[model samples]
Target chain A: MLNQLARDVKASMSIYDAGDDKVYGLLAEFAHPGELLHAAEAVREAGFRHFDTHSPFPIHGMDKAMGLGNSIVGWITLGGGITGLSLATLMQWWMGAVDYPINISGKPFFAVEPSIPIMFELTVLLASLATAAGMFALNGLPRPYNPLFYSKNFARVTDDAFFLHIAASDTKFDRDATAQMLEKLGASNVETIHDHGVEDQD
Target chain B: MSTASTDKTLAHLADFHDEAPLVKGNLTFHDITEIVSSHTEKKTPFAWYGAFSLALAGLMLLVGMIAYLFWNGTGVWGLNNPVGWGYAIVNFVFWVGIGHAGTLISAILFLFRQQWRTAINRSAEAMTIFAVICALVFPTIHVGRVWAIYWTLPLPNQMNMWPQFKSPLLWDVFAVSTYFTVSLVFWYIGLVPDLASMRDRAKGKLRKLVLGVASMGWTGANRHWRNYEKAYLLLAALATPLVLSVHSVVSFDFAVSIVPGWHTTIFPPYFVAGAIFSGFAMVVTLLVIARKIYGVENIITVDHLEKMNIIILLTGTMVGFAYITEFFIAWYSGVQYEQYAFVNRMFGPYAWAYWTMMSCNLFFPQFFWFKKLRRNITFMFIISIFVNIGMWFERFVITVTSLHRDYLPSSWDYYTPTAVDVLTFVGTFGLFFTLFLLFLRFMPMVAVAEVKGIMPEADPHFYDHEGDGHHAEHAVEPSTQQ
Candidate 1:
């Protein structure tokens, strides 16, 4: 009974199995950004949650069409900026006032007036770094392995082509039904893509 | 899709505004990708090789001169009693000023939603990073002891000596270093999507591997782009004030001091204006050559150059006004030392330098006010070169003139740069150009994803709402239609 349960869990978690030549998902190519956007809205309305649209550039209003909300990157950057400000202030106060104070023209130690420049610089630097890192982390980037790469036609997604991908892991995914829906929505081509599985990669 | 159909959609969009198209030639996204990527994918051109060789030679000269300077000392340069600061400080300020134009275009103009910046922001940002590197070399070597450079930082030494936080020079270390780091991060973030495009279109394993690593497997997912765009906007917001603060801090290095000509409240704004003026001139100088050689003139159009020239004219006028204001204030203050500094600058040994600065920075840019002159490629290019020369002299005049004639008449002397000083300054050019040439050779000089984003075809409603005669409410504003 335990062995059967283990097998069932493995099957449910396996989105793709290259060893068995298992299908990954349906990859559909659209003619342009407008078609892709509309198709994404249709797929969302059709009850598919595990889908994404791809284009060479960010299409304005794509997030709305895909049912995504405002990104949390701004809050992340603000947190980072506050952290930077606190650290800069503490470091300056500790060093100048507590640790190794110096008397320069009788000016007070650890004054805020003179420390504003460094404080501002650190805030900007940390905020920028946090923004970039938060963006990458939120997107789950550096994920070089994706089933859509198996489609040769998908190469143009970064050039001129637009694509919509519906993962097989979706509970509503019916292979034939998904392909047909994509075709009806004006997709120029729809193909089943697979995960060739992991190998030695750079 | 056919080019005609794309043009038709673009024309429909243009009905909102009478402005010219930002991207010329009615090129498609594929054409843009092909044009930008082929420079990296194909074999290197002879012209590139020639330019690289010359730049490499200059880099070598710079390296050798630094080695010689290290062997000797700061005394090797013409550092006299009063004019202890010479070519080193002048060159540092000059190069740092040149770096400002890049950040201005990439960050400030981005915040303003200037669509034309898409054509030149990538290369301009790259130039900013390289120019900062060159600017840094002088300060590092000028300390006369390269190995002890860590003393400038607030590291915990055995002696427990922390950097004096009150010093403007220390403020400079933090400000410039912070500027360099933030600019680098900003530039790299912009390059990721373009690098991903290069990766997808790549042929070789090594090339693919390198780009794959650099791009972080960017797939242009809407999920990713949503976050990416937000990050880009936030970074632009952060960098705008940071750019302004950087030049202001640099001006503080002089303004906070008790020097007769340097101690003025006007230095910060004046310095910032001059930096932008010189930076725009430098960008114009480089883009004119780069676009012609790479056959990307259609992408980076004459309209872009005309816009940049207008900025140069505006900033040049501001700088000239500051110059006049300085003289007037010196006379009105009735401080004999300050009054003498201005008189000496105009009629002193460095008068030639001051007038050269006036002609290049103040006089030449006035011609750009005329539409024909602004649009004339050869004329603008010449004016850009003159502006570069004039800005350099501006720094020289400010640094040398104030110091040469001290309050004590006996210490007044005419300062001259040795051959070492002159050659070391020239070598910095080599350092700047070598990095720039390598960048042009390997990287996408134009931001491909950004340029595509601005194209008419990238609009979501361009195809869906066509012929309905009712555009979406979120359609690009008429003012930003370009």
Candidate 2:
């Protein structure tokens, strides 16, 4: 039953492919951030989930307009920090109390006061590392390949231009209709991007 | 209030650039990218060669000093029985304190939404990493057996022994190492977007390949940005506490001891404040020369320099208060050893060092109270150098003076740095500048993506709603596009 569902989704996705090549998505460019933001709102209102806006920097309120929930990176970092604190406490206690205990100034073996600094340092260390790692993992970074790279117009997205791309994998994606809707919404350039099988070429 | 007066107040508040532009020049997005990237992409300037040569020579000297110290042992230096922690400890604390300004500017100011940091954060973060490198040299070599430095870590071995967790020295190891790791990651994560920009613009095959790998395929995808922003915020939050703790741990090294002058309740806050004061002074010294050499006068403006001087003033005052409070506390306690330590610091053999610290840190920054002097480039430059020198002396007086005249009069002797001691301290500068010059030559000195974000033209609502003249050329007419 799962295989059938997967096949059905693939069939629907192929309908937007147009058979010339495996197109990645439709790329739409806006002259200003307001237009791009509005277009993102329109795309979300139209029930497209697998779409994103590209700009030189993050636009305030753009995430809300795009219907993106708050990121989970913070929660992951918190978890990492707690784990670090517990690990540091346990390791120090085990070393001092159980492993090879020796008397130092007749103090208690598992004193909490002196261990606080190491625990604090470890917590921060692990939290920061987890934040970086989680961000990269979520972003699917270091892939070094994307269909967007083939679009000459999309390069400006890191400069002055703002863009919104609707992936063909979206359930409602129809290439011609998406292009028209983007143009109607004041996109300056609406270009259909092909996958071009660059990954295979490499 | 009258409506006319209310309107006037609002108008005044809206004039964000009534003074001068934070980033000077009518800069387009392309212009910002080109201007910053040119420093890396263009031919290596002759001026850079001269500076790098001097730095390289210093680096060689540092190498020689380290080799000699390692071969002959710590005895070659002026570390007698009483003054065991002499120049090495002083230089270590000095360099470590110098590293705080970078994290404070990049992480703390960023969290505060200080947009001006974008113009200088890149270079400042690089300085933090290099300064920490220079700082690490002292602790490593001070171990006497440099090859056995790993024993400081809590590692399991055949001997079945562990580091003393209760010791402040062990805490220092963990704190400093963690601080270094977090600062490095924060610096690199911040560099990703700019690295991607460089990768996109690179024409040479080698340059493109190198930057492409370094950027890790950052396409500025909005999904990636969502995670990136979240991670950046988290790192900044984590670093804020880490910065405070790292310096506090360094202070604990002295404060936890029973030594009369070192055992003080105010040491943590005082050390942290002095760290920030010295760090800012170093930033100002480097930035003044950098802006002049790189011709980035417009981006790193006098306004930025004035703001930095104001910070120096605030922290410097805090340090001065700490100094006075220490004396007052010693007198109030009525402890002879503590009283003597304070008096000896001012009038004893190391009186010169104490006065130098006072004049440099407390007196020199008083000039910044005058806005004209703060804004004057040459005056600010001279004052910043003085502050740097003063901060070093502050550390020297703290570490050496306290040790030179301990509880026992029989053991007490006047401490002096040998030629090797002076050479080693100067060599660390060589290491710092060599790394810093390489960073300046190859890396983007200003964060390009962040600067573009602050431009009014980048905002869609800015052109349509605002009446500001700064972005007049780029503001699109609503009718034409609509």
Candidate 3:
């Protein structure tokens, strides 16, 4: 009963129904990465706060075109690296000097010279872990479902296609207007994506 | 080759400005996806089963031998008085050395902006992970009391004992584990997008479901790719230093000792160069077979193999120079023990192994100076095998010859590896091949997204023939400016 309840809660958290009055977004299919990049720039210029571009591979200048700033993953990695350094140092000093000290060939109990390798290793390890975890967290990944998956044409996003999506929740979003705007920006196959499928919090 | 270059045509050929295509055959994005994914999507072939069965048998042998050692103790091997470190340590170093090329290609070359690395880096990184696994096994089982291996770690045990931080072995424990973890993370980060591509192409419900979760619903969003690319760059930077240091610490295992043969300041750089040398050779060995079997010749082209050969030539010479420098230093130091160690290696019971190392590592790679031979698949394969054999013997000569005739003639004894030692060594190859075979069958052996990213059409400017003024500015990646 508890397992079933947990599953129900997760399902409720994820699913979004596009009833007669609701939609997920306006999805526009662009011909190529160059067009999609320009479309993203145009969408941002039109004051749409919630818009995204999708392509098979990362298009150069897309972040700038979309008015996005530098990624914060580097800062997260730095934080993780500092934590690892502190923990590794403390672990070694306490274990060697404070907790259970043993004399080894009359060498110092907690010398930084000897501890550098482990300290370096731990720092890199933690920093790398934080980079990966921060990337996944920032992207809101492991989301097995998305309303965008409902479109059969959208399957090609991982192939050769380029796409731009403006969510219905955006204050600037009018379904027909967004479609017309995307088409004006050189997009084809402009369509409204309904939210009957599972969706996550943007 | 020089004879073919006529004076009139030489200038024209040299002035040719067009770059060689990174991908051959003019394959579309869908074609690359299909070519890589078909191995996973299609039915299992009989040959794969046959090879897998052989590998499994070898894995079983490795397990059985290890269990036998656990039951029978270290005495089962021909480890005598001074030669306590035998095949186990030799194999440990050899396999660890073989694992270096992947990170060198993926992390180091990526940082250097070598575009060709994209094609081979995925499979090479996979090799690194598997080779490290094989390398880790030797040291784990080599510890006589295997159950008490936890003592090597820094857990709060009741005994109140802590590992010696100053010891190179403890440093090794930290280094190899960290290397493995970081490599795994780096490899996975690269795999995510490719896995998402696979998830989209997946047909069966189970395969799709598994790949979907594995991919973490990666939709290749611009915002996500921004962070994703930054994370990749950071990881690559971290991995570069980590790879260099891992082998340096491994070399510290010997160099820290006062033993005449093992003690030297040159060991760190020498060992690192040798690691890359052997690692690239191993990559060449596997890729030569894999590209043919998987029909990915265009992806991992002849040019890729030739570049690897040049690296082999470069590092092979570096290793040879190190060897000669060791001899010069040994004699010049005027230490009789160090001098004797060098002399014994050349004119001792294991002189055969020493000569084999010299010929395989130094003599054969010289053939790569000829462009024709370097590009010849048959010649490269044979030389790669020679380097692999030579590198294993190099470790053997270092470990065994150094010990078989130490300072005291009274206690010195010949170190002959018993059947158990030989079989256990052979078993690691089985373990490596088995994991590698599974990876080839299940995963995208060539990095699909990365290869696509490098294609001419992938450029946003590729389709901009209208002489658009803004494209030139957009081509300057803001990330690069940062």
Candidate 4:
């Protein structure tokens, strides 16, 4: 019974086996930002869409090299801010003017001057939340597992290393040809990552 | 050039020549990771234990005092009719003021592209959260019946009553809560990259698991970074206005009032300046100790301290000017109550507090005008403490003295904080310190990724052979492959 349970847990964990033939992607390591940029541009010009670079920090021109447009987070923040302003203003006006009106100083029940502070505060509050949420949603984050995490070389991306990964799922992906291309582009180390889906076959 | 002009030009060049490296030591990527992570991964130091114990004791005292006050009532404090807004309000203002510097360093300075902020922004942002926590405590308890605190929010109820949207007190609720939420988000987003770094390096399985979850699977992917940088920039932009608005609204808690001392147009800008002054002082005080304890002096160098001191001097001068202008306006306007309020602040029962405020906020920081004193860690630390004390008194004098002898002389009574009041204030420091100590124990005090970004080695130009056309052509050959 214990042996069965252990086998079940191992199967659920989807541990990658060394002999697995299924390729998740090819990861190419670069020594510096310039090399990574040049490699990214080369990949872009070659018509690859499912490729990405990883570095300890954001490189200045890497976005342009990768052919990425400006992020949509700004638009989302603006939408959220407008929603908050409208909500706050309407809420205040309803409560003080229409709902349960009280004459404190004989001032109008709903005045724009009095409502400005709350409106301003709520706008900023919503805009900030939207920015964080939009960024995470756009980036497809909180995914605790990825095939790239299996590569030992990829670990240094957060510290000292830079990397570019070409997904096997890409229509034009050819494992041997991509590796050769990356090698020519001065990648120090190139490794093939096996997908989690391969574990089912094993 | 003439000889005299050449001499002046030389001096000008000398000013630019004295530029110091923000991060000292020939640090590599591995070295930065090791230096920062060691503080969290290694066993807690003896000094940390000692300070944490003291802070814990203070936190316990704070809890006890709050418990006692709750059991007894507002009478436990020295609050009476005239002096109703006593130590609690004073402490709230003081802590809120101290919270501003973090936002200034992280958001404002970041917006301006100040690279030096990388060394201190993480801890400063943490301080912002903790200080806001400390500040929020006073108003909650000051409400006396904490159970009814929900009424402060604009929630639907059977009573059909809503918070007065026009009241500055209500504005404070929106302002402070918004400030806390925004600061927390900003701080966390900044932490995501560092947390991933920690997760990768963490040894124990439990540590790795916790950090991994906290990091949200950040892989430093370029696509992720593209969005991340955009969000960070927008948050910084959002936070800049939010920071200014928060203190301005806090100032509205006084400025909008009809009270003689509190009613003034200058309160907004003056409060903001004073907030930065006191906040920087608090940062300096905490950092001086932190650097020594953590052995991070190379990163948070004397140059960082000098820069912070210069800010203190500038803001301190602005605050001093505000004081003079307040008095001048009172006299020139010839408003009897306004003039009386200014005179009473200077020469009344709270004259000692007023003088303390002046000497600490204005006179003490003037010592920083001397380059030697600004660079001396010991002197900077002492001056920072003085500034903290002065800021507290400034709030006390502003809140209490103005109300103690208002329009009606019949209700005049001197305010004195009881044991509960005094202990609660001290306990807040304990509360702040305890949270800060735990943060130091676990979280990354320095922003590793940000600091790495500013390093010369991170620059693409650092290793590029721009002058050698042959090598440049050779470098591009690999990319020419089909």
Q: Pick the candidate with the highest TM-score.
A: 1
Better of 2 and 4 by lDDT: 4
Model 1: per-residue lDDT, tens digit, A69-169? 78889999999899989988988889889999999999998899899888898898888889988887777777777766667777787888888988776
Candidate 3 CAPRI category: acceptable
Model 4's CAPRI class is acceptable
lDDT of each: 0.88, 0.85, 0.86, 0.86
State residue B223's C-alpha deviation in candidate 3, in Å: 0.6
Candidate 2: list runs displaced more than 4 Å.
A1-20, A198-202, B1-21, B465-482
User: In candidate 2, what are the lDDT values of residues B23-110, reduced to their tens digit?
Assistant: 6776667777778888899899998999999999999999999999999999889988888899998998999999999999999998
When candidate 2 is compared with the true two-chain complex, its DockQ is 0.49
> Per-residue error at B210 for model 3, in Å?
0.4
DockQ: the better of candidates 2 and 3: 2
Q: Which ranking of candidates, highest DockQ first?
A: 1, 2, 3, 4
For residues B1-482, write the lDDT of model 1, one tens digit per residue. 34445555666666444466788885778889989999999998898889999999999999999999999999889999999899999999999999999999999999988888999999999999999999999999999889999999999999988888888888889889999999999999999999999999999999999998999888888878888999999999999999999999999999999999999999999999999999999999999999999989989999999999999999999999999999999999999999999999898888999999999999999999899999999999999999999999999999999999969999898899999999999999999999999999999999999999887778777754454634444343211111
Cα lDDT for residue A181, candidate 3: 88
- Residue B423, model 2: Cα distance from true site in angstroms: 0.9
lDDT of 3 at B135: 100
lDDT of 4 by residue, B309-346 (tens): 99999999999999999999989988898889999999
- Looking at the true structure's interface, with contacts defined as alpha carbon pairs within 8 Å between chains A and B, what fraction does model 2 recover? 0.65
What DockQ was computed for model 4?
Answer: 0.39
- What ranking of all candidate models by lDDT puts the best one first? 1, 3, 4, 2
Model 4 Cα shift for residue B108 (angstroms): 0.4
Give me the runs in candidate 1 sitting further than 4 Å from their true place.
Answer: A1-21, A198-202, B1-18, B465-482
Q: For candidate 3, what TM-score does chain B get against the true chain B?
A: 0.94
Could you list the CA RMSD of all candidates, in the order they appear? 4.8, 4.6, 6.5, 7.2
